[model samples]
Target chain A: MTIAYAYGPNPWPQSFWDARAAANFVCGGAGAGLVVAAALSGARGTALVVPLLAGLAIVACGLAAVFAEIGRPLRAANVVRNPATSWMTREAIVAPLLFACGVAGAFGSLAFVATAAALALAFVYCQGRMVHAARGIPAWRAPQVPWLFVATGMAEGLGLWLALAAFLELRSARVAGWLGVAIIARYVIFRIYRRGLGRALAAAPARALDAAGRALLWGGTLAPLVLLAIAAAVRTQPWAPWLLLAAGLCAALFGAWLKATLVLRAGHTQGYTLPALPVRGTRA
Target chain B: MTRWAMVADLRRCVGCQTCTAACRHANATPPGVQWRRVLDVEVGEFPDVKRVFLPVGCQHCDEPPCLDVCPTTATRKRDDGIVTVDYDLCLGCGYCAVACPYQARHRTPRAVFAYGGAPAKHEAKRHDPARIAVATKCTFCVERIDSGTAQGLTPGVDPEATPACVNSCLSGALAFGDLDDPGSNVSQLLRENRHFRMHAELGTGPGFYYLWDKALPEAAQ
Candidate 1:
């Protein structure tokens, strides 16, 4: 008889960590894009429904990331005890509450609540950054982390709609109208935070910070500008929205990929060894 | 209510995993279950780099996040603010682990036994299999403390009075005490050092604190 001798359990596999990290980063990037796009302009009627739906999607993805990392996904709700002290706790309390706010705002047509949902969207960004902060990884130390994430959420939402419009062949001048706005907002964010991001990219002190800074600028700012130009040109041409939407999709996808790659690579740069001591604890 | 806390003298810690092992034994944790661990990290570079060994575990925070996301009310905070997990009520859900910033919680694939000197005896002493599939972590040796207190071993000491890990520190690196008491060593250390928790910016408001010497070349800011 083969007995499953449950003496000791094994540590979680690398695959688990890898999958969680990849999914989290993608959702985070997309969520950032969405939130920014939603806030960039005012949406009325079912048009408003787009941002709300996007917000709900982001929340779902965030919950999935959380649930996937845990040992028990179902027991996920117990973390609401000290909103005053914990972000994870605050997220637990706020996520559903925020979702409820979105629902109430959507159904009741309350502008104030929709504004509140936008603010809550900012909190969701904070929660995502909070996870990275815990790992003690230097790459996560950026003050713009919250801003970057929120922006990306907005951008992702805009990209989704743009792509959807292209697929549906919908020719609302308003839809074509917002393309430049998304590009400008995304590019501005890149310039602000990523102008001199990394040493290798910036050609300076070779500090990881320098490399990260430059990468953010190029990947976030420069690359998107190129894509946006292509997209804008396509917007003016007949039957070009479809192509522009395709181009936007590529830009968003590549933009997210490049950004995540830089962040992950920066995390790996922190693996340098510490100085040795005669004993362990005391500092020399 | 005495709020228990720990202080590690960075001057003496030897990077040993004795505390980790002791915690496992004391808690009767299963395999792949580590309530405490020794993390060896490198800081700085070249000739100036320094190795720092931090023995980390659940901070048993004044504000425990694990207690927050538990849908089943499986985790709770003691009156003194030490966090404890109820394995029986835990539905093997991993929410609390994610909420924990310290990455302190360990969910074993199955129930485990604290092997005595003899493996057979250890298996015999293991908590019954009927009670498997629950979340758990160090409870500050609550059972031992209660018993020890009754026996006058110490004012608040219990059967597991002194946490096994604290006792196992060969270099006297770890110290535990009531943070609420001004006379307690933990409180005194807090008063003396401008230490910071791992992710202070997140506002987890962790009870665990680290004090690094300013003069140290390799200390992380």
Candidate 2:
């Protein structure tokens, strides 16, 4: 018998959704973030095309991974039937819109870029709410979860944009400044999510979230900030772009790691809790 | 409007698990799946410890979170408040499973028998093709309720109309009836007993009520 069926009253990690679900959050966040950041950065011509295609491809990979996770893949169309109440359905609707705009923006015009970015942001928002809709899992059901996802996605996307900027030799201090802001914002949201949980989560989930927060603080937040700072200081140097690229990679990869931990390791289901225990034969 | 509900009296329970066995037999659920089960919870520390046999399953809440989060519209609630799953439409995405706080949802991707290999005669006969790769849960014996009620039988009072678990309960601890009916057996039980729903603060408005005489004196006290 499983621990759940046997012991029955303790929080345990949910097996229904595994690492496959996390792939959607990680890749989808980074991809959507890249689209939004690229549009906001004002990349024109080939500069815009490269990042847009890359972002769409990444998002497509996430969609494919989730498709593999569903038991009835043929009945996938049924997911779009309830957009009125289901965030997953809303996400399904937004993905195609994002793709259409992304494809058009790659070769069409700057207007398409803005449109794709809006759709991409909506897609990430839907994904965040999708995770939040898992009311059984305390760690995922935080009201701030959607905001956390948005901030982290923007931070990761900005990191990817900066890394690609290094490759494409595109420089914009204003966008880089936003990246720093996003990273710190993500850290702040993570802290709030943890504090809000406050004994509501099981021991295992609480520890897992704390460990992820620690990693986000040191590697994802602090390290990236220091690198971006140094890159700004050495703006005149020929190798400053490399410093920015390294910072971008740190931010994006660490964000991916934290989300993976959130979905897989910290996804413990709420166990049974009786407010007042009843003693047999007690009188009213 | 008739609303189906259940009440479990803590004073009368014996932790025999007869209800669990009966439910599994009636449903012919795959191995490792129990539609209704009792949780043996040992609370408090050392000197004043007490073990409570907590019966749990799908609460079939009035505000079921599972119904709202279903991406495929596979999970539904009847006008009577009994939540159900449409096996044909479900993609088994598990969103409803996670949304359900009761941990009541079950999904079987492939056919598996009680024994190691091959299907027994009874297993093959009971195997539902549509159940494969779909989300499932306790339906509160909807088939019995519908068929029995068609003949003008009232649920909770008639054995044929009641849920299999409530019928098989060894100690008469489990009761099921229309919560909307003030004169119902479950309603009388609720009126006299001090009871509470599990996780009521979550705002699910669960129909499953646990009745106790009074709060047990804490061991620390």
Candidate 3:
């Protein structure tokens, strides 16, 4: 049957073209820089404050990008009001509250309480749900999306703080331990997403997406591993954190790029279906 | 409840896309915006394959994650089961877009203009342009329903009873009616067909139903 359907408006503005491009560069690049800075630093008071502030800034900028992409800005606050069931709502609530907690902890106002650890965890979880809620995009909807996002956030946070310690000429094996953990996480997520890509590769269209993912997993992730090995071998050299910092930066960029590429390549499919057995129909 | 549903018969559907065009015209939706889309999927390799056309849109589910994840409560499912989005209340957060398992929602950009012939420009009005930035999808013509009922006409139908798409359909493949109605064609079709919802593993429980062609090629089998 020739059925009728409706169309809606595209909400983008002329200015959005420039704004989005800028946002991608700054958020994607500067965000990685901040993480590297923090990871090279010590677990001192300054180490906590700078990364906390930078993390908050990252979230704000991320929200701005989201707003720019959406045509509406005023209704952004409403998501928090409906937090009972909405992951978006939950994200809105959790992002700020965690930021507030992190700020308080960094400033030493909430040091005695368990607020810091809780906020850090909350931050990670919120980051995860942002991608997990999209049921339509199978790549984003994978069970591993949340784990990947949260783990990356934590790893980035740790890498940034540790990088700061090294840059500041402070000593801490804890920083190396953290970088090690982040590398491991990046590897694990890459594996999981690889499996998902295999499932998605039924169509020829998904080849580019698969390739982008592979690039990030190999070049971006392995870059840090080489740096880490060098640092471990020459323990006396103070540049180990710097090398780890570079690796962290690459990992964040390549990972986010892989995600964005995969998301953009996604085409809306026939509604989610169970495995269907084909019937002998018309021939090509 | 207003549970919105549709049934498409593979045997009858000609894949002309009358529904797609009518929907665009009725809504005056800008270019690049299709409230409904038909996916032409070709399955199998070489001699083993066949083509199938599938129409998709919002399923208005029983457990709507879109509504659940909308922090602003901008998106909601009516008691009658029709899911509607309040554009003015939307924050353009993209959270709904991400949360929707069906990937039904799209985040509108900050500015909107009519497109087709050329890039038409719009003068700024009093309302914030950000209102359009919110997530959007098919509202099932609720405005038509409200106005139609007020005028003593059945919404989505006439004495001959048909929706725009159903009325325009040349092959009589599209069927729409209350799934709860025992006499409804949609209900009968559902009972008769070996149908399924996409990605049941996601547990979205969408209202749209698909009847696959028994003659589909090896890949789609």
- Give the top-scoring candidate (TM-score): 2
| Candidate 2 Cα outliers beyond 4 Å, as residue runs | A1-7, A282-284, B214-221
* Ranking of models by DockQ: 2, 3, 1
Per-residue lDDT over B98-211 for candidate 1, one digit per residue giving the tens place of the 0 to 100 score = 455565665654444445323466656765543354566667666665576566664222224666777788876676667788877667665654455655655666666665
Task: For candidate 3, write residues A199-253 as lDDT tens digits.
Answer: 5543532565567656766765676667767777776866666776676566556
Ranking by lDDT: 2, 3, 1
Report how closely model 3 matches the true complex, as a DockQ value: 0.39
Each candidate's lDDT (Cα)? Answer: 0.55, 0.89, 0.57
User: How far is B81's C-alpha from truth in model 3 (Å)?
Assistant: 2.0
Error of 3 at A27 (Å): 5.9
DockQ of each: 0.18, 0.64, 0.39
Cα-based RMSD of the predictions, in order?
Answer: 7.8, 3.2, 6.8
Give the true-contact fraction for every prediction, in order: 0.13, 0.78, 0.57
Best by lDDT: 2
> What does candidate 2's lDDT look like per residue over A205-267, in tens digits?
888888888989999999999999999999889999998998899999999999999999999
Model 1 interface root-mean-square deviation = 7.9
Query: 1 or 2, which is superior by DockQ?
Result: 2
